[model samples]
Target: MANTPHVYVEWRGGTCRVKWWTGEYHENGRKRYESKGGFTDEDTALQHGQDKLYEIRHGINVTNRDGSTPMTQWLDTWIDSISVDHLTLVSYKSLIENHIRPFFKRKSVAEIDVMMFRAFSKKVRSVLKERSADNVIMVFSMVMDDAVKAELRKASPVERKSRRGKYERRVKEKKRPMAIEAVDQLARNTECHLGPSGSSLIWTMAMTGMRPAELYGLRREYCWPAWPASDPDREQREESAERYGADNSMPAIRVEHQVQYVNSKLTLLPPKYQSYRTLVIPDFLASMLARLLASHESDWVFPALEGGSMGSVNFDYRYWRPAADGAEAHDGPRVAKPRPALPAVPSYAGKRLYLLRHGHKEWNDEDGHSRVAVEARQGHELPGVEGVYSNVTPLMERRIMETLQARWIGLQQSRWEGAVKIDSQLFPTG
Candidate 1:
């Protein structure tokens, strides 16, 4: 990226010096230069200038502002410039602090190469499992790619597969999707612990495929359900539902934003990938939500048990884990009577909330519904022509509602261990 250099000789302070044009000029129209000094002789100084000219010409030593920076320093600079949501930004910073920075030490960014990265990868794999290491390495690769773009390195040291047949993908190990019956067990277990209200979050998430954050941030104004209300307000509820794109054919929940922690403070922001979407729910789910809402007075559709917004609270550990994995009764001198043991939902025993979303996808796949409709309902795009041309038909929406409602009815009929806990009524008896 440099141009031809002009070699020159000079003397200052009784010492020989060499100077050369660096293919740049100032705004004042004077050519900028790079120089070497204290050569102790004319020939030596002149030779130094000539050598620099060849180095610059061959692109071996073309002096520029973007020189090598320490790996840790470069990572800090790169992370600061990246645009990501606060939670994601926090995850990337953790990867850098725990894995990338410590291993690299004071090594310069330019010092890294494909071989060095491969070794670093092996180290990560040794410490962490294969999939987890891959996740950590992914963040590091993003930093290296930026370094290449900035001219700190000619190419990314992170070796990757060719973009063709048998292409490699990131290692993302997902838990098996929960079966519909198992989803019922998970919901019923929560019900057994905290009555019907506790189970609503479980059923809503499993059926609607709402992310935990989105569900936690759901507002009453956005979700208007009519069934199970002691006094129905059809006009007012429908008006509220219309604002978020609900209709007679398809009852929907609006996912406008999510609750998250930003700069150590709870905040509301757009959903992941900005996937602001309307998701259709079965009549049963809509009714169940109405019942849950009727019992609460907060603006949040789902408030914390302690009577406030569930903002950035670690619900997974305090609430979800106990319900999913089940807990043994604990009794000691500090307790009068031990609480009853929570029986684990076999399919969700070791899983998390994400698996419920996965379960939703599996249900759609099994129902033989339109791919485009399924993708749209799940807040995802199908990609290519399938995503652009295809649209969700009224028939597809009907089929979706029928299939989801069937699962709820099937649980009502099944004589499983947790079937007794399933709510006998959601929609009107009529």
Candidate 2:
């Protein structure tokens, strides 16, 4: 036997054999060794042994030499390492189990070449929408990246050009903002169907532009008729007033949490992007909310019928759909014939409820509010150092509230005028 550090070459019967320590332990507490030989030349056999020794020293697992670990096995380990919100984890699991594992489970990590990935992407695109396919590709890329880090693969086969090229050409549908008249009509119809609290809830969403989850998370304690002086930041009110042209004493709503359904349970989680913001409301909306609050005895401003947080599914079905679709109140009838369909609200038909928030942003943009102020109000952080230093001044808040007030009054007047015509036909007052 001729020996190097962790490699050896032996000559037997006119053939040279190379062997190296693989640096792995067996279950019986013995070190593992791998050998390959059939070289007529002793130097070539010794060189092969030296290369294997280098691989072992650099932490490469010889057991995975053929990349035999299935993609599904690696994915299980990858998923277990993830630390995120439960709902987010659920989403990841869904993407992996439903989309990824089905296609790649039996394939080894090394088997996923660029061509194979492109084919997988095409298959995903065929089944899912563009945005959804993009999301799956993103998660797949992440898993492949982890495989590279774990030394399961030499490098990730996910190429940016292959993943983004086709999807990037797919134009994202622009969200159309609702007209003020439509918003008012939606509110009136909600009032007609679900009464005053429902009307107020829709109006609050329109005025504040809060995310649906954030709106659901609003509690009685967070809704204020006037800014709370006991707040830790109360001392900044004077400076904030002078800076942003805000009254500082005006009513505001604290938006620190959002309602999320995790593990089939309603959970109060931090706002999106972890952005906590306080929104000042118009005087008219403040009065409307005040009336709304008087109707609820629970901590949640918009509690479910049985109490606790209101689920979006329940709100959409029981309240929003009927209002948006229009409904009629019947006197009394046992007739079995299908009742005449209520008139479809043409302005709001096929529209999502979140468009109200988009409409609010449109109002802000039309009013020429600063980018930082708009983003902050919308609970988005400005990019770069600007977000760090630029704060929403009191004056900015005051102006925002004032502008919203004007829009609200204008919408109300338009709605009232529209209602009078319908009322005259229904009541026929001389």
Candidate 3:
């Protein structure tokens, strides 16, 4: 072959031009172009081009490679490992096919370079927020990685490039934690008016820091009036008891599994790794949970409106918010108009249930309890790389519940200035 400055080879579509510095040539006479500073000379271009093309066609690489695998194949292999209980297959499949596959499809995974990855990430960021883009990228990276593990690609170029520089902030959305005093006010004013179910709902969440899912997912078996039979913390204490001659007291709750509604079926799954652990329950909340459990139906502690499980978001919006609103004495949005009073119905009933969850998280954090404990209790793992594979433990759950109750007590007495003020009716018990 001539030492042509610009390499010319037959690609699937037609004759293609590859820069002298960056091109690949296959035994079948196909040539591919690379984004890097392509070959500066004809000889360099020809040799490198041939090497890449052969490597892509033959799956020959020192470290790892996905050259022989189509990007679609890699994606499917990667997607198989994800537990999509929280997300629907349609949504997951859409993101993979529409958003992810088109960009990387048919490209040799080994050939994906920094520039290509940067462009891919930028495009994803344009569609999703920075944080969401990061997540999408993480999924992509995981998929590509698995492809490499399966000998589909040499390694994930996206992962390598992702580690190189200051990461671009993908999502800018900020969710402000609810104000602590507002929570207290809501808790105090609403406690009495909110029926046992409602009151118990708020109290349990504020104290245990459980996610609405965990709350709804709660089974009668998890709650203990006295103490759990097989609490690891107590077992650890018992070991200490044997060594130091101290009496070991078991924990109050033994949260193991939670019910998740998938495909209209309530499937029992382990809590997020963080939430899987148990925590000690405080005396007050322990008593409350015990009583609440005593009064509950056997299957679900907090039944959804009908037999079907509720979407956590929907439940919070329709039920919890309305319940919170019922505790308020005032009518709709306050007005300075000539009207003597607003409608008899509470003003905030239309609000979503997220307010309560947000409020509870804030109250928990304000006190000395750890975020990990709260996350574990709520079945939310710490976000980022570490959350993917973590599991929950009984002891962790107990600590989370105990910490939550302690925080709830603290919130009852807290009165911070300039906070969102729910009426005194919301926190009636305090």
Q: List the residue pairs that clash in candidate 1.
A: none
Best by lDDT: 2
Comparing 1 with 2 on lDDT, the higher-scoring candidate is: 2
Pick out the ten consecutive residues of candidate 3 with the lowest summed lDDT.
336-345
lDDT of 3 at 425: 30
- Write one digit per residue (lDDT tens) for candidate 3, span 1-430: 5544444433333333343322346679775344223344445545665565566467553222235456777677666766654544445776787778999886766677768888998899999976667667876776767766776556667745446778876554344455444444444443433335556666666555566666667666555553343334666535433432232143344456656667676677765453464445566766666676576564555555353444333655444554545433433566432212111123234554555656566655665555565566555667776565565454554555565555556654553422334443332231
Taking all chains together, each candidate's TM-score versus the true structure is 0.77, 0.78, 0.59
> What TM-score does prediction 1 earn?
0.77
- Ranking according to lDDT, highest score first: 2, 1, 3
Report the Cα lDDT for residue 61, model 3.
38
Against the true structure, candidate 3 reaches a TM-score of 0.59
lDDT by residue for model 2 over 219-327, one digit each (tens)?
A: 7767764334323465554543444335435677878688888767888998876778778889898888777778768777776656677654578777678767766
Order of models, best TM-score first: 2, 1, 3
Backbone clash pairs in model 3 (N, Cα, C under 3 Å; residues 3+ apart or in different chains), count: 59
Model 2 stretches astray by more than 4 angstroms: 1-67, 162-169, 226-248, 327-331, 334-343, 415-430
